[model samples]
Target: MAPDYTLDRNDELLIAVSLFEYSREWEIAEPWNAERAWFLCRVICERHGLSPSEAVLELE
Candidate 1:
């Protein structure tokens, strides 16, 4: 089930910025875009209470 939650704008922005920085650091350290993408997708899904597939759809 999808989450009933909606992050405030501030929280959303913070998560986005943190994810950006984490993604950059992960790429620099490991250069694994595919793995990073999946990891990020999972994190986003978990945070928002969506399944990975659902999260991907909503993201698109």
Candidate 2:
């Protein structure tokens, strides 16, 4: 289940950015680099109908 396109792009981008920042900060603060990280971020973006393309996916 995911959100529809009813929401504005700005709103979606904000959510995407928040999740992206949190992911980066957490990954930096801690040391956990696995596929799970990408999965979680993907879930977050999908739930909010925010495209992950806006996120800097550098989880390696």
Candidate 3:
């Protein structure tokens, strides 16, 4: 069995911001970083109910 968990609004926003930063850094990082970043981004998006495209959207 697994413990249940949920993200409050703040946590979700923080993760989204971090994901955005990781994406920006990915551009300047080594080519190999793209794979790792992509995987992490996908997992984050899935867990947070966010789409890959929406990950880059500006939060209001």
Candidate 4:
């Protein structure tokens, strides 16, 4: 099933920034999209058994 959370532009940017800091792969890419950030967020949430909001908090 898909995640129950919806991220706004600020949340998407926050996720993108976190991804950039946490992953060299994303760093090399530089610019990140909401789609990619959302996908990554879902992956993280699923891997850690967290909700999307919790994942963002944890990432922060």
Worst 10 residues of 2 by lDDT: 51-60
Q: CA lDDT of each candidate?
A: 0.58, 0.57, 0.65, 0.58
Quote each prediction's TM-score.
0.40, 0.39, 0.47, 0.38
| TM-score for predicted model 2 compared with the true structure | 0.39
Q: Encode model 4's per-residue lDDT on 4-46: one tens digit a residue.
A: 9987655664664465345545444544554465567666556
Which prediction has the highest lDDT against the true structure?
3
lDDT of 2 by residue, 1-60 (tens): 887667564555555566655666677565465334556667767775555774434221
Ranking by lDDT: 3, 4, 1, 2
Q: Write the per-residue lDDT of candidate 1 for residues 3-58, one digit (tens) a residue.
A: 79878744543554455456666775666874575576557657777655554345
The predicted structure with the larger TM-score, 1 or 4, is 1
lDDT of 4 at 54: 67
Query: Candidate 3 vs candidate 4: which has greater lDDT?
Result: 3
Cα lDDT of model 4 overall?
A: 0.58
- Between candidates 2 and 4, the one scoring higher on lDDT is 4
Off by over 4 Å in 3: 1-29
Off by over 4 Å in 1: 1-5, 30-60
- TM-score leader: 3
If both were scored by TM-score, which would come out higher, candidate 3 or candidate 4?
3
| Candidate 1 global TM-score | 0.40
